[model samples]
Target chain A: MASPPRLRAENLRSALAGPFDVSVAAGRCLAVTGASGSGKSLFLRMIADLDPNTGEVWLDGRARSAFTAPAWRRAVAYAAAEPGWWTETVADHFPDLPAARAMAARLGLKEALLDGPVLRLSTGEKQRLALARTLLRASPVLLLDEPTGPLDEDSVGRAEALMRERLAGGAAIVMVTHDPAQAARIGDEHLVMRAGKLEPP
Target chain B: MNPIVLTPRDLAVAAILLLVDAALSVALRLGLTRALGIAAVRMVLQLLFIGYVLQRVFAIASPWLTLGVLLLMTAVAAREVAARPERKLRRYGNEAVGLIAVGFATAIASILALTTALRPAPWYDARYAIPLAGIVLGNVLNAASLALDHLLGGVVREKPAIEAQLCLGATIGQAMAPLRRAAVRRGMLPVINQMSAAGLVTLPGIMTGQILAGLDPIQAVKYQILLMFLLSGGSGLSAVAIVYLAGHRLTDARHRLRLDRLA
Candidate 1:
């Protein structure tokens, strides 16, 4: 029998979003595209268990309730659109400096930017840094919500490349984005969220 | 020197102080004159009523009565803590957190004082237990309220940041660590300020009251120092407890923030 999908949502319904089901296989990306306020982000939050919802989510055949929240979150990371950084210096966010540097470079960030204060970074820089921070965890799956919302075209391309690399390495991803081309470029499967429900692209 | 007893006639003369305040309010057109007058009347009535109640409480000296009074005070303090915050836990949540945090601090602090420091003939003597508990409760109430306010407001303001941290695999405690620290610090700030400026800025109310009541300056100073230390301990414990409890209330078992807990 084929291995269970890497990430599976079974009738996961958020307070504001739907009772929807979807699955993404390992080494694949499922891109969710929707208009603003169409519940794409809400769907991701539900899968990540960041919002109160009905139904069950299974990761690699393990029920979400089986693992502790921290462990589940570590395994299936959620990268929010507007990421939060608690420290003053950028490097403080990542545990390993060398890995952080490598990830930063992969996301088009300069090495010196690590030592600088996070408050002074531009919006695009912050966005890319947030993604780098999430990717640094090497979680088995990624739930990305508009991960490249603020990046320019070149940065977007670099981000897409990094995501493609993650998918190539056998990590499953669920990404919410407004860019159809982004969906077309990296997504192995496509779902559009509308009126709080998921539909075929 | 003996402290002179003030007759009603003598008290009438002291009442002139309110007129001075009223006059100042009128001169500045601050419109506080009527409020001041009403407040003065209210203070007089409340103090007299409380004085009568304390006399009866001391005479009875019942442990059950003492516990009842302490619980009542705790409930009132908890309500104040809940009401002062612009953002707060839901009514029942606020009350529960406040009662637990403030009640715990006050009980521990007062018990320590009674058993170790005061050591009255009866450890449960209302004179020492009630007053000590009241003073400690008053200070802890302030600390607890400040902590709850800071924590509730911080959670709302930092929702995006907090959720982000949660998204990054932080446990609930890890996600809320910064705001929790901030809330505790804010709660303890008043006590810290009082300690730092004790001699320089203003003589504290307790020391001044003792001095005015004919205690020796040195004796009053010793008592003030002890009281300050107790206040510090009480405030710190209360602040930390309130923040931690409030933090727990704001999140779920899944480590996700439940903003709906807040009003």
Candidate 2:
């Protein structure tokens, strides 16, 4: 008998999005592309249970409802495109400073940047740092929204390599992006979101 | 010493002081003349009505009557607290939160003062309990209302930061910790200022009233000091209670930021 998919969303519906059903196996990446208001972000939020939605999401055949919201989020981590910073300094957000520094270096960011105030970082720098922060969790399933939207070619390549590394370690990824070429390069399967529904591109 | 009694003629002479305020409003085109006149009339009527009610209650000296009056005062204060906030909880949630915080703090403070400090004959004596409860409720209502207003406004303003914490696997309480602390601090600020300024920049109202009623200056000062401590303790308790209750109401069992709960 075949093993159950690593992550599965069945009949997921939110106020602004969904009625979506999809499956992603271990060690695979599913790239989603959509127009600006196509509810791509909302879809990811519903899957992570960050918003109020009606859905059944399963990780390794375990129901999302079975685990507490925080536990489920910890297992299925969502990295927002424009993540918010609560503290004044960047170092306060990360639990392991050394690990975060390593991840920052891997994402083409300066290790010294971590010690400075968060307000000083540029938009692309903040995006990369946020990705590093999320990656440190090493969740079994990763939900990424426009992770490379603000990065340059070199930075994007570094980020894609890092994501591929996670995938190789048996982590499933669902990424929302606008760049079709990048999706083709990084995505095992490409899907387009239109009017809150996913479709084959 | 016996205090000088103010007759109806004395009050009519006092009414002339408000005419100066009305004249200033008219001269400045401040559009407050009518409001000032209505407010003056309302204050006189309300104070006179309360005086009459208190006289009857004191004459009867019944516990149930005192309790009834206290509850009525608390309900009215709770309504006022709930009404002050711009972003209110939906369907009387604010009122309920206000009542719990205000009622609890007022009761605790009043009972402590009446039993320990004053030692009124019955302890639930209307003369002591009603006035003390009224004073404590007045301070607590302000603090609780300020805390609720700050919290509701902060939740809306800091949605992104709060949601980010929730996404990072924080429980509702953990996520809202900073905002809650800030709201409580904001609520307690006024009382802190008042306490610091008492006997220095300004004499508190209770102390001034007691002195004017021909009580010994030292006795009035002691009462004022006792009141300052009680007011601070009561305000802090109410502020903390209301902020936490409102925080729970804003989130849900699933730890989601339920902004839809606000009206």
Q: Taking the candidates in order, what DockQ does each have?
A: 0.75, 0.72
Count backbone clashes in candidate 2: 0
- Give the per-residue lDDT of model 2 (tens digit) for B34-151: 9999999999899999999999999999999999999999999999989999998998999999999999999898888888999999999999889888888999999999999999
Alpha carbon deviation, residue A77, candidate 1 (Å): 1.3
Q: Where does model 2 exceed 4 Å of error? A: none
- Name the DockQ score for candidate 2: 0.72
Candidate 2 true-interface contact recovery: 0.55
After superposing candidate 1 on the true structure, give the runs of residues whose Cα lies further than 4 Å from its correct spot. Answer: none
Q: List the residue pairs that clash in candidate 2.
A: none
Residue pairs clashing in model 1 are none
lDDT of 2 by residue, A1-201 (tens): 999999999999987888999999999999999999999999998998888999799999999999999999899999888888878899988999999999999898999999999989999999999898888899999999999999999999999999999999999999999999989998999999999999999
Candidate number of the best TM-score: 1
Q: Give the DockQ-based CAPRI class for model 2.
A: medium
Worst 10 residues of 1 chain B by lDDT: B82-91
* lDDT of candidate model 1 versus the reference: 0.89
